[model samples]
Target: MGERLFLGVDGGQSHTEAVVADERGRIRGRGRGGPANHAEQPGGRERLARAVGESVGAALREAGLATEVSEVEFDAAHCAMTGGADFKEEVIRSIVRARRLSIGHDAPAALAGATGGEPGIVVIAGTGSVAYGENGLDRSAQAGGWGYLLGDEGSGYWIAMEGLRCALRAVDGVGDSTELGTRALRHFDLKDFRELARAVYAGRIDRDRLATFAIEVERAAREGDASARRIIAEAAMWLCRLVIAVAKRLSVESVKVAAVGGAFRSLSLREEFAQRVAQHLPLARVIAPRFDPAVGALLLAYGAAGVDLTEEILSNLEKESGR
Candidate 1:
């Protein structure tokens, strides 16, 4: 008989990633595809299917397991996505065949990856932001992740929007002068704030596109722009609040906390966030994630199949994946 195979997928707002692993917890292959969120929108189900199929198919091919068949069977498959999993089971089943399947929110997968399914918190700040944690008591809690229109405080979108607001205020001579104005104008290739305002109002730029401006904001902060620094500081505070809220709910005195996502790529922002978290939760330790969310999903897949995740397996995974 062929060797048993397992699959793990992280379907996020920015993109979808899949990993194929063997029974011994060694990563065989990995693949990436387009975003796989909003499964309830028009054409959403098709998009999700395509994203999953594209990523998983590539992984299977890389693993030397792809055949002429459209559907690949797996011993177990676990998918963790940005939105809740309630609406995606049927769509996923149509794309892949698995003996054991588990689908749920992306937070748990992220947490599991960050903490190795131990007890801790993971703060994910991408286009949006959220903090999720477990306390080893079969209890878990989450904070933030309200999306752009609602909260998403300390997220890339929030930081970019705050930078733009500061630029507008500065241009109008109502706020502190900073380099954000020139940076913003140049980043968007706009002649002036008038053009910027019109483009945004006309829906020419979506949240994801706008959220990328946080990079410019981060650069400005690094260059010592006071307004930019303040924005980042505020963002750090907001993110810290998320950690504190989860910690309080979990009622843990000490826990391992890892910050994940693109926004945390900024060293300045990461330092600020670490400082803030330390200030509030002195007992909580901020550490690097042992693996990314995709690997986290893979860990969950192992759990779903009743596989024992021993030290040898984890060491093999870390050695193979370079996590």
Candidate 2:
């Protein structure tokens, strides 16, 4: 037998990421691809299969290994993909059946990455938003993730929607004026409110694209747009609420909150969210994730292989991730 290796995947609505690691939890390779939301995409099953195969193949190639390597040489493979769909499970089962791989959900992979395989809360705020945390014995709970329509508050979609609403209100003189109105108009290439309204009502502004407008809101806020700032502040508050809710559910006095996604990357937004969370959960510690979700996936792979991850293993993985 050569040596056993493990694989971890973070399959999300926006993108799919994979990582390969050795028994010691040291990342050896990685790969990434586009969205894998099986519930929404056409031919979602095929897309998921291709994404999983391509990502895993890339990692294996990077590690100078073959898919058909000796079974005794590989420890295990696991994946965490988004969309709790029956089709997703079917797709995962197909992949595992074909390659003898193991798989899981994207949330647990993110949790593993955030807490160094320990128990902690993870807030994901990309195209959508969700908060997850684990207790002893691997018991876990999740909040939010109601999607963009019913919930997904504090998400990129929510922020963009609020920004558009602010713009529309300003146009109607129902809200304070903001540069966001003009900026958003330009972003969508609309000359006026009438056209913007038509586009929104027609479902022309998809969540992925609307999320791009969030940057405009951020810019306007920086430029002293009162409405933009208010919207951002409100979004931060919603995110903080989720953290508090998760902490209370777990009954942790000082929960570690790891913020992930493009939205939380903004220092201003992170600071605002941290402040709000601290106000409610006084002992909560809101911090940036030490490693990316893909690295977390790698940790998950190692765990599935029955490897106990120590601080040294995590440190090595962090160093490899350039953290």
Candidate 3:
């Protein structure tokens, strides 16, 4: 009859988050760290171990938990990590070894959060993009997320790359001119396309760093810039296509679809994406996530511990979210 604690960790490419909750799903603590995408960073295992420790330790401290809390008191922990299939097992094992917690991919945790642990589809568009669909069973299929070089269409990196392409084209007089060219030059402190190209080619710029241009593209679109507008439209269309594809694959007509990621934080893009989804798949219901992915991770943790989240637990979660 001792108090039980659960932990959820969302290990993302841009950032990592951890949440601690009681058995009743009331959040008691939280922690965060930088860039837990093991596939991208060198010393991946070690970094993940450190991140899990730091995040969980911080959450425990915040929750006023004693350092000597028994493993039995710690009912369960879940980790949602991002990466390709090749890295999935390694990531899970690393997390399990580091935290002694149950772990799953970030996608399922996100999906669970989006649908409140129900079956649905989720499209994540952050540093990367991917569509994941889950039926009533454990079955799920993913589309895209092949990585920056191979795929990840409709993601922040994709949008930023397209923006840069448009900027370069404008500079070369091969496409409609855009302020993006000037903005790109100024943003990167480059004198011209040659300088930008040299820097990019020399690997001076990383994927996430280049993806920072996406916000500029969003701004330009809001200001009626044709090139930026077109890019956003294309990105929206691509993401909608993924949603449709996942829906068809799962054969779950009208399943709830949740949008998750930093890119979706842009109001214009979110509206555009919702419109596109409605237009193409009229039966599907696209919604903003009910909670942050980290919270979703927490839900998964509860499930892993055989703790069924009651309406009271969900209400507490909502209150914590200020919803």
Q: Top lDDT: which candidate number? A: 1
The TM-score obtained by model 1 is 0.97
Tens-digit lDDT track of model 1 for 44-132: 99889988988998888887788421556789999999976466999888887899988988999999888777889999999999999
Please provide TM-scores, in order, for all candidate models, with all chains considered together. 0.97, 0.90, 0.91
Query: lDDT per residue, candidate 3, 250-295, as tens digits?
Result: 8888789999998886777899999988888888898768878888
Higher-scoring candidate on lDDT, 1 or 2: 1
Give the residue spans of candidate 1 off by over 4 A.
67-71
> On TM-score, who's better, 1 or 2?
1
Supply candidate 1's per-residue lDDT for 195: 90
Sort by lDDT, best first: 1, 3, 2
Worst lDDT run of 10 residues, candidate 2, spans 67-76
